[model samples]
Target chain A: MTAALEFREIDVSFGGTFALHKVSVGVHEGGWLGVVGPNGAGKSTLLRTVAGAVRYGGSVLVDGEAIDGRSQRERARLVSYVPQRPVYPQGMAVFDYVLLGRTPYLGTLASESHEDIEDVWEALEALRLTDFAGRDVATLSGGETQRVSLARVLAQRAPIVVLDEATASLDVAAQHSVLELIDRLRAERGMTVISAIHDLTAAAQFCERIALIDDGRVVAEGTPGEVLTESLLGEVFEPSIRVIDVDGSTVIVSLRVEEDPS
Target chain B: MNAGRPSSTRLRWWWVGGAALVLAGSLVAGVMVGPIRIPPIEILGTLINKAPFVTIDTAISDRTEAILWEIRMPRVVLAVLVGSMLSAAGAGYQGVFRNPLADPYLLGAGAGAGLGATIAIAYGPATSGWFIDPLPLAAFVGAIGGVALAYLLGYTVRSGRTAVTLILAGVAVAAFLTAIQTFLQQRQSETLREVYGWILGSLNTAGWEEVELVAPYVLVCLFAIFIGRRLLDVLAVGDTEAGTLGVRPGRIRLVIVVFATLGTAAVVSVSGLIGFVGIIVPHTVRLLTSSSYRVVVPLSILLGGAFLVLADIVARVAMTPAEIPIGVVTAMIGAPFFAVILRTSKAVVS
Candidate 1:
């Protein structure tokens, strides 16, 4: 079978500046690929290019076919995307907002049916958000709101899910819970995930393979043991970091640099 | 999106029913409570008599018949049509632009129509009859012209048709057109009175021809808008979200803007730039119902018509003999009510 997702020489620019270089990556069916990069390193841009949220050069294909060739409905059914920072449609209640994921199934003139409505509730329940269904989206706490965003993507029921910094804003415990939940969901449902994460340790712990990006280029890509080495991360990140194994879980420890007077 | 979860489907139906009842009451009062007194039953009998098979012995007189058919009936119909068109278009504009403050008059249609009317009053024959209603015709052409200009300028300057750019372009175009209209008003004394009166807005000269001018466009636009209501909800989240939802936000915005502009131009061409109805009616509908366009669009039509008709009645009776402008009444009432709604409703602010 073909790889579930592929990016071959994807290049994206805004105005005159490049957001991503000629980047290429792919994930196997039902596999998780974590993307880690410093700020402005084009990690989010790579995911956005695959999501078709940004104009890009070259091909980003799903299941061996170019995505741009597909209709909006087809692409929506094939892949779901969650932006890092979502501006929730103000005044929309959580239930109704999540229910928008059923757009692919709905005819232009028709509202949601019983099945679609049931699926929205199911998504809300899965996210532990059933209680907040009637709440205005603007009033949600950061974690709850992020879960709601994830719930919307969940309701899409797509095979491939891409999240850009899905847990960046959560507390440490909340982040672990969200990562754990995503892992459990993927294991149970056989979902293929490509997440752009800011946390190197979490990416090392959760993802089977990690791609480290720098300045719009994929600088290092392999298993965490191979890619998350001190020398590679030290050069790319401002803070020197060490990656070590503790109880079979990967941990990244930051080292302070001596101050130098200019 | 889920029925009754947010919308309370059954209660929503009750809301619709309630609005229809209000509209019926308004229509009845609109006809019966005019300058000449007529009973409600006789008015109903006169309306029913138009049908081939149905005839009632409500003892309708020729004077009452003429008053109902010739005078009140046409004006009320025009009021409903104009009200429904403006309010529906307003809801559509708000959804497409994803802004609560958006109005039907946002795209320079008000200014364009006013300038068009001003020119006709100053230069065209002032005593023109319904057959050659030069003022409304000129207003229609001018409104279309203004919107077209704004769209072109917005498209060019913004580099893409961003909502903010379009609104900015509209503001600039409207201001420029308003300046020209003011200059023309100052140049001619006769033009001053006509332009000032038209600016205030009135239904004093409403007739079948005005109704005919507005009905076809409103019906078509309203049908088109209602069919595409779900797109509005999708678009509310912005273009990227809309695209992921299997919608082309750009195409949807263009379709909605065109349909709404056509309906708005049609009505404002005849109604002489009636203010506040478009903003207040749709705002009120969203305040009462869920913001889903499926509910808001239809309800706006009913409630907007009823609201405007009631306002017009106030305009008629508030200072009788010398009529208060319908636009003044709508603003005086709508502004305060809308302010109260805005201050109290946190949802609207969001």
Candidate 2:
């Protein structure tokens, strides 16, 4: 079967510096692919290419069609991206911000119809954000803001979802809850998800497949058991680490050496 | 469960209705409170008499009728046209840049018009032609040219945020044009009074001819901008996010700039360089009404018209016999109001 989303030899550069170097990956339909890497690992850049926010060489295919030649609006319908930092204009209401997701379906002069507003309300309700719909976006806590961002993507109603370290700023509980929400929603909607998650244990716990990247290149791509091995992680990441399976769930722990008392 | 919802659409219509009434009141006051102080009854009668298939016997004298028809009516209409044009354009600029302080003049349109008027006053045909005056034409051309130059230069920067680069380019272009205008004024010191009068701005010479000149451009441009107001709300989220949401930010910005520049150039050609209406009106709309462009753009248009007509009335009455420049009146009110907004606005970057 054709992959739901495919990145074939994607190369993105800013000026003379390369952000992504001939990167390639794919996610099957209704599957979750978690991308894990250190900072500046080209994860955001890769997601941005899928979002059509940046120009990239090579092709990104959605349902076997190359998206590179598609207009921004057309690409928007195929894939929705939740950026690491979502800009919330002061005084902008949460409802209004999320309604912007319907922009792809709107004509230039068209206002949001009843159905559009209904969709927005549904997204807000699903995210348990109906109470905060009228609140100023800037006034929201970080965790709430991330949920708001996800609500907006849900409102977008695209077939594919890409999130770039969306939960990086949240506390552990918030991160788990948010990811759990996304996991449930994705399954219910039968949507393809490619999320760049910093937490390896969370990635292992949630994602069916994991792709580990380092220095703009994918170092490992397989199931959690295949890619989350200590030898593979130790070579790519600093210090030492151990991957243990307890009750059929993977947990990763970093090994930090203590200084000797002289 | 729907908490804190502003209900922007319903609230917008309410403010729009209120602003329309204010505009009506301002128009009446603008015409009735001028130098001659025609009675409201006479003014109403004369206005009704002129409407299609309606002729009413009125107490208005021939002189009063002439003043109302030939002078005040045209002047008031021109004020509405110019005021709404500037404010709508200002809201457009502010939204596209995602900066509250951005004004219609931020793109050098005012500076370019000023320079053009200065050039026309300092060096022009000595004998007046029966047909056209060169000054307004020159000013119109200069305003569009200035914006074009700014856009071209801004396009070259390509790296950082385009909005910031465009504003910087406008600043550089405005400075260069103003310097040339200053040099021209100094070279022909005899024309200083005429140049200064024009720079200070006025609706003094407004007549049916001037009203006819700018109305179409203002109407068409305003319609285009109003239709695109929702896109401006999308733009408030910043360019990259807007792009992800299926809006081509550059395309929207260009459409707005072109229409706004065209409208502003038309109005400025006839009315000269009226400052502060652009910044003051839109910001006021945001402060009092909804911050969304859906509300701000339309409210700004109506309230901007009222604000300027009232300002023009003060210009005519504040220092009787020697009328103050309308621009001076706006600046006097606008500067302090601007300061107040700056202190109170939550959106300001610290």
Candidate 3:
């Protein structure tokens, strides 16, 4: 299978600080890849690089075409990114905000057509947000807002999706609903999904492959069984934890507290 | 949900309808309620049949006709045009910056224009006779000069800049220019009263020539902003997001800033600094139209015009023979409403 998105020796810096350094990864078409790291470990930076939000000192090829020369709109046509927490303008109805995802496809100052409205409706329906279409985004609960953000990405209809902690703000039920929605989208649409996730257990359950990033570098990349071992988790996360297989599923649970006297 | 669409449309129409009714009523009231107090019917008759070519005598005297046509009519017209320009410029500025607090005066344009006007008032009379009479011309030149200087300063910060730095620089420049204006006002005591009156702002002395001078510039600015309303929508989202949506956000912002400044300068030139109309009208319109520039811009223009006409009417009639400054009336009305809005509305940064 051809790689849907590939990053070769990517290095990104902000001001003088390095966000991501010499990182290389390839996501095959229809692949579900999870990026797990500690806070400030450049996971979001990696996703932003793929989304073409930041310029990097390396090559990013989408479907064998070099993306360096393509405009942001061209990249958006291929890859839709969902930020962790999307800030929306007040008084914007959920339906209108979702319709903004279709901006890239709109022609020359034209209003959204019936087809565009239908696409928005479809996205809302898929996220079970049909009832909330007319509701103000400012009035939405945290989880509902996150789902609305996802619905916007769905509306874009891009083949590749980059989600930076897309479900972090959601409650437990909403988190499961969002993850299940992503699973359904991947299976139905054959989309390549790359997400920066915080929950290792959820990552183990959902992702086909996991890439462990630490200090702006990917330290491990493999199947969940290979990458979610005790040593790798310990080294990358700096957490005193034990990885256990419960009902044939890997789970990470905190063990004992370590106190250091200075 | 589909039912909501029709209701939204109806609500929008109702707003427009209500504003139109108020505007028409205000126009009648404004014409009839001057010191001479011409009846509405006589005023209308005079307007229709009292053109240069045709003469039909009405209840109103010839002096009253001159007062209505040559004095009050032009002043009212100037007020409406300047009001529309300021409000539209405010709406455009708010959209481009993605901040409700943003106004057309955000880039030192007003202060620059203020300086230019002050300078012209000080120097023009000594050099030329014709230039000494109208203060708005000097103000207009100053307004443009101020905005140009602000843009130059802002451009020096970076090749492509954001709204925050531009606004900060404007604050600094405005403060600096205001200090100089204060110093000049103090030195010229005889002209100090005139400068003070100018700063307070009034449409009391405007006539046909001033109206004709300002109308075209305001109209052109309004037309340009109306045509670019769609691009303004893209800008409501942040620059990066707008860029991803195929717009060069930096270029769009530059164009909007220039046009908004031009519109603002044109209005300020005619009316001096009519406080709070620019900031308050746009915010009010946003609440009514839900921040869609397509709706907000046009609505702001109509409502803004009505607001100023009403204010100018109050200025003319409230004190009877001695007129109150139009700026004083607007500030008194706008400041309280602005406070209420700030207190009541949930703060959304963008």
Tell me, by TM-score, which candidate is best.
2
Following a full C-alpha superposition, what root-mean-square deviation does model 3 have from the true structure?
3.2
Give per-residue CA lDDT, model 2, range A46-99, as digits (tens).
889999998899899988889899889998888888888889888778988888
Residue-by-residue lDDT tens digits, candidate 1, B1-350: 44445431213668889999999999988887767789877887888898899977778889889888988888898889888888998989999888887888788888998889888888787554556778888888888888888888988983666888988999999999999888888887776877888888888888887888789998999898888887787887888877877888878888998888899888887778888888898877777666767778888899889988888888888887778888999999889988888787755543
Candidate 2 chain A lDDT trough over 10 residues, lowest sum: A236-245
Q: What is the per-residue lDDT of model 3 for residues A1-262, given as tens digits with 9 covering 90 to 100?
A: 7888888889998876888999988888998899998999999989888777778889888888888878767777888888776667677678777877887787644767777787888888888988887777777987788788778888889899888898897777888878988988888889999999998988999999888898899999889888988899898775686899899988887687867876
Task: Tell how far residue A92 is off in model 3, in angstroms.
Answer: 1.6
List lDDT for all candidates, in order. 0.84, 0.88, 0.79
User: Chain A only: TM-score of every candidate?
Assistant: 0.94, 0.96, 0.95
Tell me which of candidates 1 and 2 scores higher on lDDT.
Answer: 2
Q: After superposition, how far is residue B10 of candidate 3 from its true place, in Å?
A: 9.8
Candidate 3 local Cα displacement, residue A152, angstroms: 1.4
Candidate 3 CAPRI grade: acceptable
Q: Write the per-residue lDDT of candidate 3 for residues B1-350, one digit (tens) a residue.
A: 44344211112677778777877776677677766767777788778885668876577777877888888788778878988888989888888878787777777777777777677676556544574455666677777776676667777886446677777767878888888877876777677767767777888768888788778888988987776776777676677666655567777778877888888887788677877888889888766556667777888888889889988888877888888888899988778876787677763334
Model 2: residues >4 Å from true position, as ranges? A246-248, A259-262, B1-11, B158-161, B337-350
Residue by residue across A128-179, what tens digits does model 1's lDDT show? 8888887788887888888888788888998899999999999999999889
* DockQ-superior candidate, 2 or 3: 2
Of the two candidates 2 and 3, the one with more favorable TM-score, higher being better, is: 2
- Order the numbered candidates by lDDT, best leading: 2, 1, 3
lDDT at residue A117 of model 1 (Cα atoms): 78
